[model samples]
Target: MSQNKKQKGKFKQKLTDKYRLVVLNEDTFEERFSLKLSRLNVFVLGGFFSIVLMGLTFSVVAFTPIKNYIPGYSSTILKANAINATLKADSLKVQLAILENYTKALRPVLTGELAPEEIDSLVLQQERRIIDESRLNATKEDSLFREMVELSDRFPLVSNMESNVKLVFFAPVSGQISQEFDPSVKHYAVDILANIGAPVKAIADGTVIFSGWTTETGYVLILKHSNNFISVYKHNGNLLKEASDLVQSGEAIASVGSTGKLTTGPHLHFELWSDGYAVDPVKYIDFK
Candidate 1:
């Protein structure tokens, strides 16, 4: 117990021992600044100052723009500029697509392939068909002897069919329409007489399902459009696009020519098919 108490006393004394830190004026030999410090006091003061310095460093990086210089940090302006550039690029692409579509629509008009005003005038012309009802006329004796027939098919179910009036169809050619659609004669197309080499335009966006020379129609190009509509341009001078080629509205797909044995002069024979049946092109398209 005595030896242990002696060792403890020596250790405590070493830590509590005071020392003088003094500075003297060189010439006068007088003390200028003096401090009485212990070993324990020196250690505590050094630790406190180190902690304060570290706190200041942390504040600078956390609250000031200098933080952006760190390895993983980014500035606000740089991020905002990046976002703006990406958005601008997307918007420019959309604008370019619209311009391309407009140019395609205006090609035929600028090249004088078709008259521009014909489309507007054709829409104004009301569709009319004269039916010869003379076949319905019956003599008095024949009418009395005629058996009563149910007129079920007379007022047919025409209400459920789709109407093509609202659909926008481009003029396939610009010329005087020579022959109109006559279902009675099995002629389901219109013959437009135009000068040679006149550009023939696609009526709408479609794919060329048939583009080849035929014995009956000569050089023919057929496009299949949406909503089960198909367009046939026959008697063409040449085919610009081939089968399976994608075409936009008003794009040039052929030229006017009388290549078939059936045509008499340079003209375009255009046909429009809806569902499985053939429809009148005059009712849907404006071929001048």
Candidate 2:
């Protein structure tokens, strides 16, 4: 009886194993299909999957670092500056065009043939007034738009006088130099002593850039000249030129006295700078 039962169980197991199925293409065909995959087939398929996965990981790693190449040509600061400067230059061109038209219109009126004396008087007066207006507009525009256009270009200059390019001393007034131009430590000034007053002359032809008193350099006078250079006269008893005043070489600019914090006595401290660098005044000056 036990053997008969065992034979029946074996027959059931065989039937169950033979009739098992899987569907790979249920939509395409209704025809029935069967497969008997062994352990070796499963192992081969798993190895292929592992190889494909490794290839995918390698590809991802290789391409990741190469994505950042295009925008690295110029720095962010440069790009922004280029954009802003271009816009400003365009605006300036428009402004310049308007100015040019006004000048052109005036040119014809000035060149009209009135009598020499009549034309001279009228043209001179009109030109002077127009020049004054242009100058005022230039000042206003400079104050309003300097920072925006510093990198764009220099203002177009038209003047009767030559450029202020030198500043020197008048009759030698005796004074002890309290401060001298020292290149090693970046101090650029010659401080001279006087009793109450001494004449300060323009070292070069230049427009008065600044003439005022500060906490450090009191009663200062800064002159901007050609060759991208500036001459500074500091610690003055009196300042003669206002800001934007044109000055000639050897023109009186100030008086000698102590008015700033770094004063040893009542003296004049003079300096020369080029392109924001304080150069040795002795190189371009003769104390005698």
Candidate 3:
């Protein structure tokens, strides 16, 4: 038998015996190509495309976001939170009212006027509520935006809910009884205890004859109904309607608060007038 032996080469042998050589554009070439882009190009192209977008914002003029308001969806949630807070605040006010009635210095806003300092405090609180509502509304908007983003990968219906009037109430927010309607002393309204910023409602459908702030009443709303009936709302934290505005019955007219001479804790002094005389609200509407 003939014996065969391996021959040594002039070059060094590779330790990796299974190694294979590779070259670009070669028949058997196999390698991953990679590249790193500059930051400027990536920023300008990848991230800046959303900057020049035209739609709701970035325009010279803007429409009210009321178009985007999801009606009872976001605002309801906000109002619910606000109402709960208002209720708790009213509980505190209930405690304060007992002390307030005894303290002549407390000043009745219904029959009197508030000073500049008091008005400033009220305005600040209103602004704070508006801000909180805005923030909460923004959160809802953000959530809607995220949903839109997810839907962008496919197709989806409208992302917001609609607003339609459902029920009509004789009042707005809930509260406690303070004073009963009295025609003898000309106390024509029923007082309900509430924290400053609680809402007030119209007793019936009518046009708003007056809506403004006064020294005697921090805020006031008067509705003129048919059959010579007039509804007056006083000591509001804020007003929803303006003079000569048409409003529906059960529509929110204002927020409950103590701003008038007759007020102690935050409460709504609701009055009904018929043929130039004070009447009781309890006669027509059922309590909530």
Clashes of each: 0, 13, 14
Candidate 2 residue-wise lDDT, 5-121, digit = tens = 999988755545533255556688664666665555556789999999999877775566543343545555678999999999999999999999998867866787445687578
In terms of lDDT, which candidate is strongest?
1
Best by the TM-score measure = 1
RMSD of candidate 1 to true structure, Å: 21.3
- List ranges where model 3 is wrong by over 4 Å: 1-169
Q: Evaluate residue 21 in candidate 3 and report its C-alpha lDDT on the 0 to 100 scale.
A: 38
Q: What is the C-alpha lDDT profile of model 3 across 1-288, one tens digit per residue?
A: 122222232112222123333345466565545444444455567555666565425353234445335454345557799999999999999989888776755465544676768867886665432212233355777899987786776543432311112222366556777788754454667887877776677766789999888888678888898778788888898888999999877677788778877678788888776677565677655545
Ranking by lDDT: 1, 2, 3
Instruction: Give the lowest summed-lDDT range of ten residues in model 2.
Output: 158-167
In order of appearance, the predictions have TM-scores of 0.43, 0.40, 0.40
Q: What's the lDDT for candidate 1?
A: 0.85
Cα lDDT for residue 14, model 1?
A: 85
**Who is ahead in lDDT, 2 or 3?**
2
Q: For candidate 3, give the lDDT of residue 282.
A: 70
State in Å the error of residue 275, model 3: 1.7
